[model samples]
Target: MNAIELSHVSTAKPVLLGDSLTELEVMRDVSLSVPEGEILALIGPSGSGKSTLLRMINRMEDPTSGRIFLFGSDIANLDVKELRRRVGMVSQTPALLPGDVADNIAYGPNLRGEPCNPGDYLEHVGLERELLRRPASALSVGQQQRMCIARALANHPDVLLLDEPTSALDRTASRNIVELILRLNEKLGLTVIIVTHVMEHAQALATRVAMLVGGSLIEQGPAVDFFESPATETGRKFLRGELAEDGR
Candidate 1:
């Protein structure tokens, strides 16, 4: 069964320019499916709505029209907090709370009066347990990102949504994060949807690739086929960096 599905989803925002009102379409009738335990990379040029599309899966941004399903259930019908707990999200930058590492990791479960052992989650993200008491701000950017992943994992989510997860990291840190994501998916059978501007990261992490251009899905297929023999001219142009602000 598909872990997540977007059926005829579209989003638009009203914009006012010089006293004239206009509707800006962010996504246009997009339909996509992600199977269980699969890593699907969402790629496109800047302003192509890749991030917007990812955010919609978790209802961080709701679509103006259409529906989203999680494990065959309509997400709109689910309680928002429960939905978020089931679908964890990690943004480009780690937004840690103003506390030590352990506090940040325990925040989610604490809200529900549940117990959380921070060390176990830290191990999942390849972080040492000794840092549990360290201040969140003291950790390096890479460590902070890993901590964010750990915090999300503490929720025991079925699906993980990552938006530009490695954009701010160095090459070494980025590669570490990619490996960590692969490990989590393998170990926990987590379905992952990642939006990335780096082709190399997508190539290394994604089992399938989906490309959006001008807020529309242009092509999507197995990773090997999409990388080597893209079906559309726009996809090819994106690979060759022909599109303006490509892969941002």
Candidate 2:
């Protein structure tokens, strides 16, 4: 089953007012899909709407004119609250709640009235059980990031959306998190969609890579192919590091 399916998805067009103040058009006719249990990376330069696309997938933002399906159901027609519960997201800066680790991890399940064992999730993320009582702010950056991931997993989400999850981490920490994500995908069959500016990181974690530029999807294919044979000029330039100063 396809975990996510999008067809002709588009954001709102800019509306010009009487005074000629123009609204910015963020996303174009964006469309993509990820099969169940596959890890796909959404790659692009900053402001390319990769994050916007991720948000749309989980209904954090509604598309102006498009359809999104998750787990075989049209997300537009599903209950907003329930749909979110099944799709978890983690961003670059770990948004750990102001509470102990256990409480933070259990927050989602608690809200849903679902039975939760924060310890189980912590273990799944390779954290110690004793850290449950630690305050979220007390852990090192890497540890805190892992805690955030564990918190997301506490809900047993079917699809996980990650947005530049390792941007702030050191090389070692970033590697660890990447390995953990791969392990989670392999062991639990989690369908993961990651948005990343770092091409190397995307290559390391993704089974497939989708490149976006100027709010357009340039190309998407297996990880190896995306790196070796980018189909679009934008992708080729990006892979060659020709757009480094421009942040592409």
lDDT of 1 by residue, 1-248 (tens): 99999899999978898899999998899988999999999999889999999888888889999999999999999999999999999999989898999999998999899999999999999999999999999999999999999999999999999999998899999999999999999999999999998999899889989999878888878898999989988888889988775333
Q: Give stretches of model 2 more than 4 Å off.
A: 13-21, 244-248
lDDT string, candidate 2, 148-197, tens digits: 88988988889999988899899999999999999999999999999887
Error of 2 at 202 (Å): 1.3
Clashes of each: 0, 0
Highest TM-score, which number?
1
**Best model per lDDT:** 1
Model 1: pairs clashing at backbone N, Cα or C within 3 Å? none
Candidate 2: count of backbone clashes, pairs at least 3 residues apart or interchain: 0
Q: What Cα-based lDDT does every candidate model obtain?
A: 0.92, 0.87
Instruction: Give the lowest summed-lDDT range of ten residues in model 2.
Output: 239-248
